[model samples]
Target: MTLEKTPPASADPSPPSASSLAWARRRGSVARFWKEYRTHRAGLLGLAGLAFIALIALFAPLLVGGDVQSVTNAPGTALEKPSGEFPLGTDQFGRSLLGLLIWGARISLTVGLLAAALSVAIGTLVGVIAGHYGGWFATVVMRITDWFLVMPTLVLAIVLATVMSRSIWTVILAIGVTSWPTTARLVRAQTIAVESRPYIERARALGGGHGHIMTRHVLPNVMPLVLAQTTLGISSAILTEATLAFLGLGDPLIISWGGMLQDAREAGAVSSGHWWYLAPPGIAIAFVALAFTLCGRAIEAVLNPKLGVAR
Candidate 1:
């Protein structure tokens, strides 16, 4: 009997590890998501454009060096029209417009991202709390939210930015605080809808606490909405930042698209018909905003087929 020898060794090893299984599932989910996303031509184009700009922004220093922001060492004469020496022309301070545009992207994109993230984080937190614990707490939060909703967001942001020290963080803070009410309202509505589901009740019955219900159940369910909102919010944030910068509220030291516009205005570029001074930054802003909007709409459509992607 012993000579019969043991059965052949198992052809397969033990089941995949928990992490491995999870990673496999995530990989599949990503692939499926991408497959759907690819169907949106505008989204793909927008994504490509944004990616290219982001790379330029990411490598600004290496591509053009930091001295581009320095007026004292500008490579060309002030407001020189675009030519071989300076393709995008020069700003009022004689800094290369091309270099300023590139450097500007880094700061502008960063502010947009950070401001959007801050707005979303606040909104998500308020939404989850209000949704998970309804009654008096939700009532109070919604009341406050309603108050904010009724106010003019831009006016409020301007007020905050004006009162606070003029800096990048101030701009971010102003944008973040003033812009979150819409997201909070959105998330709250989604949360209320999500909690009405049967699984929420089951989770409650299973001894789940507020934290567990909110983080595990509510957040995941509402994440698609949050993500779409975040994407859209970035465009809004960028526009807002530009508005602020144009109004001379942005950080003076930061060279950004908006700042370029402000500088051009100060230099009488607009009145003088020096289109070169203003066109590049203006186009960049419009293109970047359009790209974010496209990606945002695509994501919303992908997450919820009811909202089809715009053509």
Candidate 2:
């Protein structure tokens, strides 16, 4: 007796269109990144708070309509409680604390962004070349990185600032130059991994030049790591700048958070019980640094899924 055989399930005859498949993959990546970021509630809150502070900093002149460095007529207004006249109260010199905080935000964020940009650009170049070449070039670059790694960054920065006359650009350039070694090492390691991939071999077989391979292939793949590092680097740069300023090695003309802390220290604000003088700027520095750190960690979890899995 012959039994009737069940027919096997037929697969779909048509495959997904190229455009449709590409769009789907793009959407998936974005959604995954979003989900990973949303998993960090503290990071999100820090980002929001930083955004608010940034807005205030960006619009300080519009918000308070006076020179950030200009002395006000409120000399007798020291330690006034937060009121309509002075929200966040006044410092020892009777300058508006709110104004100072906002202006300081501008300086901190500017230095942070500029230094990060410079470091990332230089580091990416150095890393890509060293990793791609992978011989004496790599050895030399890595040794240079180790050299900087051994030096105490703060002491080096202080020495540089002292020699350079403590200009704002000097501080920014110093931070950016000094900080690139770590980022270079990270990028080189990432590039080494990516350069060994089959696609890189295919590109090489197709006669793609080092410039093309580095720019179009290697750089894009290592960018997430570079970006995460940049965020963290910005925080370090700001802190270093502030520390330099506190040591009287920062730009004297700029009313950065470090400058405020310097003024407070000189006036003995710490012992005077006028917490208003030092507290706001100190909090601003701490909060801004915290924001960058949180954001960096969130991005790291997204980019390095191994870290997430380990957690």
| TM-score of every model versus the real structure | 0.95, 0.86
List per-candidate RMSD values in Å.
Answer: 1.8, 6.9
Clash pairs of candidate 2? none
The lDDT values for all models are: 0.91, 0.84
- Candidate 2 lands at a TM-score of 0.86
Candidate 1 per-residue lDDT, tens place, 1-311, comes to: 35666788778877889999989998998899999999999989989999999999999999999888887887778789889989988887788888989999998999999999999999989988887788999999989988988998889999998999999999999999988888898899899999999999999999999889888889988999999999999999999999999999989988989988999999999889999999999999999999999999999999999876575
Which residue runs does candidate 1 get wrong by more than 4 Å? Answer: 1-4, 7-12, 17-19
lDDT of 2 by residue, 1-311 (tens): 99999999998789889999989998998898888788787668767877988898899889865564666665445556566777777766677878878888888889888988898888888888999999987999889988987888787777778888668898888888788888888999999999999999999999999999999899989989998999888899889888988989888777899889998888787887778778888999999999888888878887887886222
